[model samples]
Target: MGIDGVVFGCLTPNNWLDEEALDRLIEAAEGLQITFHMAFDQIPTTQQFEAIDWLSEHGIHRILTHGGPRNTAINENLEQLRKLVNYANQRLTILPGGGVTVDNAEELAKQINVNEVHGTKIISLPEENND
Candidate 1:
């Protein structure tokens, strides 16, 4: 498939991520990259850290996270989120997503110390479309 990496999606504590699945995922990604995505509301910070650590132990380096609701502006609690991101970045690539927009994307990037912040509104419209 010429795949660069394998990503495990919709990971949660309630789901039975058996050894077979983990083994297969690892075998398939033996010489490639591996990442996992977790919805922000699905797990708590402690569990998130544990998952990240587990992935690191298995040589996985990329970790993606949903940033929860848009109503919960990251800017409002930048300090807390920044601390969490900083901690997680030490072990994995913490990609924050969900409810992101151009208005707060740059600020989130800066606060989280990430060069790129994923958002639906990060792209700039053509100048001609401004009208």
Candidate 2:
């Protein structure tokens, strides 16, 4: 296989990164770009900055996040997302997702100062129910 990258994440029951599990994934994904998925949002907000430092030190390439509780809309979470992008400081990519749509993607990225965004509606509408 010629896959270029992988997205994965793991958290302990207490809402911390399960470094043991992540180590396994990292080893398996060696030589490929690795993105820690939205599970980043599951960690306690107070601990998130530390998590970013940890993930960056471990060579994670990106973080996909909604910037807050998943139930909230992405627009409502822009401030937090902005903080995350700023804190990342290019140490790793902070990808804002959830409720992101093509219609709003440009402004959203500009607001958060991120170069990328992610969501089901990021590019175009589904033809039918393809999702």
Candidate 3:
């Protein structure tokens, strides 16, 4: 439909990547950019790096993640996020999301040395209209 890119994700009941399902999605994408979404965070920490390697090897362009458990502040997840960025080694982009906000996004990006991030609040709104 002329879209430039698509976010794709699938996980098994055990929180591992569902390669079969993902393959279908990738095949359907037909060369559009693929960003594996926050489902990356649902995988167990012990397996996350391996998942990164797998996704990179399989042609995923990036991953959107919170860097740690759901609902935790992004600051607390910085260490793990940094590790993920390092392990990726430019093989794929690590786009942090979850608790990121305009107020903290710049500092967080510098702290992790990543060029991109994700969040609804990436652009701030006035307090009265904020939602």
Candidate 4:
């Protein structure tokens, strides 16, 4: 597939994963950068940290989260997102997404100090390439 990375669109509610299966998937992907996408917000609040711990331990590169349920503004979940950013400091990266816009990326990054942010505002591709 010569793919650069993979993002799991949704994870189990508890972030439950089969490590052996994951290892196999990683092997199949040939070590493409792995990201647990926005579905991370579906995990229970109490379980988020634990899941992060396990994910970081498993060598996941990033977790794209809005800090709460999907479609919610990251602005509204700053506290939780900040906590996750701090917790993931050196182990794994937390890529904030959902409702993040170019106008607000600065404010969000200023507060969280994370170098990477993910959302529609970051890039805008033409509706149809005229090639």
Candidate 5:
């Protein structure tokens, strides 16, 4: 079964994924993109930086995070997000998500100086019908 890649979420938190599981995933996803989603924020900041280096070393393609705490506006964590983005410069991709919306994605991305942006709010999804 050949799939484009895998998104780590809707399952367990990123920290919940032990090294064995991550290695297995990395091995199984060779030649494909393996994204570590927002759960990155669940880990302590100090550990998160170490994890960033480790993830990059292990070939994790990208990571989605809110930078500080979950549900906090991206603006509040701009400094932290910028640091993460800069640290991940060529090692891996850091995608700022969570409170990001289309209205602010541009400014955030610009300030963070990242080419890629994440979060569902960027796209306008149609409302559901009540019928």
Candidate 6:
């Protein structure tokens, strides 16, 4: 893999993250040649912005977020999350994951206005396993 960067997936605990954990994650990421893409749980818009700002201060350029749970798909929360990402587009690359699927990936890509969308299984299992 010619990937020059990496994404660090950390679950936001209880809708809130411990500063100690964040600090440690940042420290760990700094040792690598990859850009850290932090994946957070369902956090408020304000907090989400704060997280992005904090990561930026630490030199993290990519941010990935869990797009809510599966139930939220029908409630428009996913769309709302996308809006938040778009709002913060100037600061970093806001990539959404978790519930992303091929069916709604195009919609998410369009709504978020991001060229890339990340997912664990975006490619079929066989393709992923092949490498």
Candidate 4 local lDDT, 12-130, one digit each (tens): 43456545666666666656898877767777888789878977887689999888877676788999999998888769999988888878887897888888888888665569878
| Ten-residue region with minimum lDDT total, candidate 4 | 9-18
Which scores better on TM-score, 3 or 4?
A: 3
| Candidate 1 vs 4: which has more lDDT | 4
Error of 2 at 115 (Å): 0.6
Model 5, 17-90: lDDT tens per residue? 46777788788888888899887887778787788887899888889988988767789999999989888876
Give each model's clash number.
0, 0, 0, 0, 0, 0
lDDT of each: 0.63, 0.93, 0.94, 0.79, 0.82, 0.62
Report the C-alpha lDDT of model 2 over 14-99, residue by residue, as the tens digit: 99999999999998999999999999999998999999999999999999999999999899998889989999999999999889
For 1-118, candidate 3 gives per-residue lDDT tens digits of 5799999799999999999999888889877999999999999999999999999988899999998988799999999999999999999999999988989999999999999989
lDDT of 1 at 54: 66
**Residue-level lDDT for 60 in candidate 6:** 66
TM-score of candidate 4 against the unseen true structure: 0.81
Using lDDT as the yardstick, the better of models 4 and 5 is 5
Better of 1 and 6 by TM-score: 1
* Candidate 2 residue pairs in clash (backbone atoms < 3 Å): none
Each prediction's TM-score against the native?
Answer: 0.70, 0.93, 0.92, 0.81, 0.83, 0.65
Model 1 gets an lDDT of: 0.63
After superposing candidate 3, which stretches have Cα over 4 Å from the reference? 125-131
Pick by TM-score: 1 or 3, better one: 3
Model 5, 82: alpha-carbon shift in Å?
A: 0.6
